[model samples]
Target: MGASLLPFQVVDYFKPGIFPLMFLTGPLLYLYVGSLTIEDFQLKPIHLLHLIPFMLVAIHRSTIQVVPISSSPDLVENPQYLFNKVYYTLLIISAFSYWFLGLQLIIKHRKKMPLYFSNYTGKNSLNWLIFVLSLFLIVFLASFFSFFVNNILGLAPVSYTTLPLNLTVFTFIMVYFGINQSAIYSREKVHSKLRHQQLSPEESLPKSGGALLSDEQIAALSALVKNYLTDKKPYRNPDYNLQMMADDLAISRHKLSHVINSGQKKNFYKFINQFRVEEAKAMLADPSFNHYSVLGIATECGFNAKTSFNRIFKEETGLTPTEFKQTLERSTN
Candidate 1:
């Protein structure tokens, strides 16, 4: 809609009645630029450094319009030509950023492989990185060549005229593929961390392997936690702390912490909330609870607010309450 309404023609971009529409680009620019800046904080220095030129190009596009000189036979004015030249230059620079980062990632990953199976690098990180780098290069070439051919022949006066600047189809496709590749690498990183998690392998044994608790002790602690969840008791009591659970379990705070951390593989608060989330999930799936809002279900589960409840629920089940309920309905149907 916006592309048709605001064509690549410089006159249409800055039309008499279109100033308001053009002005609306300010907030939109702020959104993209602000998000990119925030992302720079989380990204590696090399990745963020590469993205700087792209950010600058986005800013320039957001600010300036390259109008053609009508009276000149060549349709070249000094200022307009300079703007077009700089615009394409910035775009090419930004493409180089992606190319460099992609190559660096590939090289770094390749160096990490074992020499014996280096031939299998094709099945590992190198293959994934190369595929992503190739995809981005294709997008970069397509956009740059498309813009170059259109502008050099005067088919499109503005640098953005050949390709829809606001839409950034190539950038979007490149980012989508990059993120997919990153996700695979990030999961590998997580699994690698998890593999070497414990300092003492002996202590990593399951509670079931040894009598960490007498049957009586286990039953008492389980009953207390179960009742607290079933009763929907608020955790807001000023004195409600780990000490309270320890006292109830008739164990020292240190021992109880070990039991929760080592046995259950979670902190006391998280262990407790896992039970609450289970309660909430049952309620959400029950047809009887269908009339209740999400907030009501969250409160019934002893959560302080719907926000926290929904976040944790999604983390646990990979689905929101609404999504889970929809799945339940679909399965039953």
Candidate 2:
């Protein structure tokens, strides 16, 4: 919409009333990212304030375009030039500001993933969002630089030509990620609330004189975690996580995370999914379980999604589930 207002003869038929619609991009992008990270995110009445700048810009442009001016040929030839300069400047600032905010939100969401989720694969990891926001910041910076060079310096008008291409690339990137990226918090709502309830004031307090675990204690806790998983098969529970394991072991979530990170040298998801992949392999290889399909075996082995099962299976073992099953069949035959 903002592009249509550029000083191009082909877009002359395009009206200039809604030129400020470009301002919506920043707030809308922020809102979209917020909705993805925050479960049940609602539009508060306060959020309507974001649209005020757009409304003011739109009103100014509408008045300028409608009001007759006899003296200035600049106004007659290109009335939108001044507006475009201001709009593009604001656009760049808005884009960068919101992109930074979105990036921070994704970082926070990623840090919180281990607290609420078992499998941090795919959408739950939020790497896609980070990448998108990073790319958006880069594009916005380029746009701002281009606008500054063309409109302010007046050295090379061709610099402004790249703005449309930059926007097009941005659009394609957003659409591609939008279609492929799954929801980060789709399955984490209940767990998130539960985790909030589990938090204690002591946990948040500074440990002034709290005893630190010795190396031996860490090793023992790691061994116990491994043994518990092997004997009890808690990984077979789809909802199993560090917090759940900590509760079962009668330890704090922080200690369990420390043991997994320092002793096991893996995150909670990797450690748990490793066991799940092993279980899936065993299920796939067993002739007695031949009645189960690949997805059935995945579900039976505590994988919520077949894609995750396949991805993790391949990551752990070089072969996919089907290939592993085929190899097993050949060896048996």
Candidate 3:
């Protein structure tokens, strides 16, 4: 990006073969997102394979810059021109492909988050990164079109300033979010914790658990979970999560997630939020709770944030918590 910001004469003099380094754009992005969003991410020899494209293209461009190994006078008939055309097209395809794959990684990782996380937080949500990627993709597409017009068609006007301008805006956005966005997982702590707790692409089933749950076992575990939730009302705790409930129930987190998903027909987050919403509904109607404000009622009902509580409440009942309370008030008056 810095290279593109400089004057052509300066860039060519100082960094002639920087075009080939463009191949690194996609690989580096995918590597960054993958490390954050996925489990078991580590520096491995296999990861170096992503660099091969960059290395090959860089070497080819460097040879041509120094030695001018091949050249043709005819514009269309030139082999070098044809290969360069294919090169630019492939660079665009490669970068876009990695961007799309990074999007998929974020999505898949997010779906699994609700299985363990009962409430949303920055750490649990990558929607901001998704927004970032969408902007990057748009900028990238625009820049590619600009490249095709100015350099490929030998037209001078459109592509000259737009490419750098797009990069400059995108750089600012990346910096802004990079500074503001919280880390999804700390590598040192999360890697070790994931290995112990085991939240991978694989199903959240048991490893040491041996045999799969029989229908009878599933029913028994399901009953146990339901009975405990009803009797103890652990869902009333604002910070409660699958792990906490799992520990209280003397079940592994994996088995707890599996039971809730299979038996209750909801992810852990939705399953717990359902209970909280029901509790809020009861309190909304009960005169004894009328003294509490909606947020106070929500806090007592296990919601850490009023926004989450209201959203979840509306999802469960067609009315917001305030609206629900007003409905009860109107009926009484």
* lDDT values for all models: 0.50, 0.70, 0.71
Off by over 4 Å in 2: 1-18, 65-80, 187-234, 237-333
Highest lDDT: give the candidate number: 3
lDDT of 2 by residue, 52-145 (tens): 8788876776566432111122434666465566666677778778877877777787877765577756566767767777777677677668
What order do candidates take by TM-score, descending?
Answer: 3, 2, 1
Ranking by lDDT: 3, 2, 1
**lDDT value, residue 333 of candidate 2:** 89
TM-score computed on alpha carbons, candidate 3: 0.74
lDDT of 1 by residue, 98-215 (tens): 4664466456545533211101223344364466456546754676676665554455544244234423554465456445432212211111111222233223323444547645
RMSD after CA superposition, every candidate? 15.9, 7.7, 6.0
- In candidate 3, stretches whose alpha carbon ends up further than 4 angstroms from where it belongs are 4-16, 66-86, 121-123, 155-159, 183-211, 227-244, 247-250, 285-291, 304-308, 315-319, 327-333
Please give, for residues 210-265, the per-residue lDDT of candidate 3 as tens digits: 55565555676788778778767878876567767765665666777887888889
lDDT of 1: 0.50
Model 2 residue 304 CA deviation in Å? 9.6
TM-scores for candidates 1 onward, in order: 0.34, 0.57, 0.74
